[model samples]
Target: MDGTLLTPPKRSARARGAVLGALMLGAFTFNTAENLPIGLLDVVAGRLGVSVPATGLLVTGYGLTVAVASLPLTHAVRSVPRRHVLTGVFAALAVSSLAAALLSSYGPLLAARLVTALAQALFWAVMGPVAVGLFPPGVRGRVIGALSVAGSLALVAGVPGGTWLGRHGGWPLPVTVAAVLGLVSLVTVAVLLPTTRPEAEPAALGISPDRRRFALVLTAGALSATGAFAGFTYLVPFLGDVGGFRPETIGVLLVAFGLACLAGVSLAGALLDRSPHGVLTGAVAVQATGLLGLYAWGARPAAAVLFLVLTGGALGPVFMATQHAMLHCAPGRTDLAFAANSGAYNVGIAAGAALGGLILPYAGVRAAFLAGGLLAVAACAVLLPGRPRPAES
Candidate 1:
């Protein structure tokens, strides 16, 4: 047996699961905090005495910070204890949430969002590799699948939950609750995560990558993200203004989409171990089809809901595929790979939201979906010809 396998097997499994669960909860809270403003946009806009476009600055600012911070933070903390770093990141997020909750003015709120974005960047930068490290190679996919499932549940639960809470108690209440959850996650990480370093030492896993391949993967990830979020960011308005669904009903539909994504992520992980590129290519195509279908048929409530669920399901494999590609591009540098991917994802969020905002003023929600479809198709074009084969660890 390997020396690293000396710990009690049952205790070890439970500890690893708990750590993953905690990380998932952190991911949930981070996303919830980031997106809560989306569902409550009108309310937030009115309260801050600003236009919807101004309020959107909150999202854009947060995304930009995350995009800029991921790589540097990953490099700076490469040798730190995983648990310690996780705890610190969550604690910072909790502080930012508290600031957002307490402040009533726009400037303070924007500043608070920037702080949360930094924490979120660090949190995601650590999660992928940490999830991989917690399990032996034989079960790596399953462990990551479980982590993805937890994140999916959060995506499904967080937005609607925060929206409902904000509706009932005001914007600050949901943010406060998110802060509390961050604290809880912090405690969970400190207690459950084992003390471990990266299997490949920091020096050995050189943080640099071939510039050409790096740029390609990064561009592909950003384009794919742009496609995914174009429709997603405007989902609530589309359901309400176009599809004639009530807010509560829209929430339910969003939850359903999230659950579908959870299922997709689980299935994708299993399939990815065998043929990652094929899975990713299929996912992108399916998502593009779903986005276009929504644009064409979204006026009907039932059709809109069904197509949204399909879109979410198709989205499930995209992340895994992107991560696989990044790691392959830089086989030894897991931290840098994840950081680059995380940055691309943030850029995607910013691009998609900005595009949606620009189009929603004149072209309507359908136009946003069309834009997303075009981006997805572009991503497919970039990714298909140069798909890298899986590298042996």
Candidate 2:
């Protein structure tokens, strides 16, 4: 036999690209499904004969489940094959979405939402590590950036898509569409993803942290996420109530914000490959500026929209940088680090939304923006130069 024949056949680049694409698409689909509830709160409340705040609990419940489930699930599945785990999670998501689509009562719907959240936490907790394993170190940031774009697209498309479906065919239509997308994702992962297990160092795969560095990064990530969510959860109301934008106009503005985020992630990926530290610092500062600008210009529709878009742009880069930092800080413990970051992000979302809710009833929607700005500034302070100790081992 020839020497070439003795060597294993090289995997085709196209095949690898397909796998990456599928993974990203799956991530996008899951996030879209998770967020669909946000746009449909009013419709769901009306249909279930519940108050709007009660309907909002669906979001809270899902987020809380994700926050609690990600780390433990990551630890439990550390030794499993990545593709198998992804396929299982996708299958779970599809099942949950179908259940939600079929259920008429609030209790069953809530259960379905919780299941979806569980699957989502599992998927996201694994995605970063899988992406890193798929590519060479040189291109890892770019690969991550590409995935971020797909996720941002989901955010941009999912809400409007869900809203349109709800309007044309009612709430169940959007949930059904989400389920169908999850099924498609399941099929793609099963067929396309590689079955081989990568040999990762034990340290890189665990939830136990390097202590000093992990704490600093986690704290920064949580605060930054809090700031972003504070403004984001209340975006529609802020645009409509304070900026005097119509509901249609707010929707259009949100699309603009999503586009800006797509651009930010793309730009930041290139920067991350060179200097993640600079990108992190600049992104945090810009995000703080954008939030404060929104608050300052709350009365001006044009200016507030401009600021909001800038804020979205800043958000993607900052998040990507923080995530990259966490992975680097822990070296061999990427899954755990990422899961911890995801938890922090979810915690921030919950905290920000709760804070926004508290202020909304008392200080009005604009106060939410101010709160977000303050949180961003605080995150920046925590992550500033010469503050946190370097990673160990």
Best by TM-score: 2
- lDDT by residue for model 2 over 281-364, one digit each (tens)? 778888888888888897797788779888999887876776676656653557777787888888988898888888888988
**Model 1, 378: alpha-carbon shift in Å?**
2.1
Candidate 1: TM-score?
0.84
RMSD of each: 4.1, 4.8
Scanning candidate 2 in windows of ten residues, the lowest lDDT window is 1-10
lDDT of 1: 0.77
Instruction: Give stretches of model 2 more than 4 Å off.
Output: 1-10, 196-210, 386-393
Alpha-carbon lDDT of model 2: 0.77
CA lDDT scores, all candidates in order: 0.77, 0.77
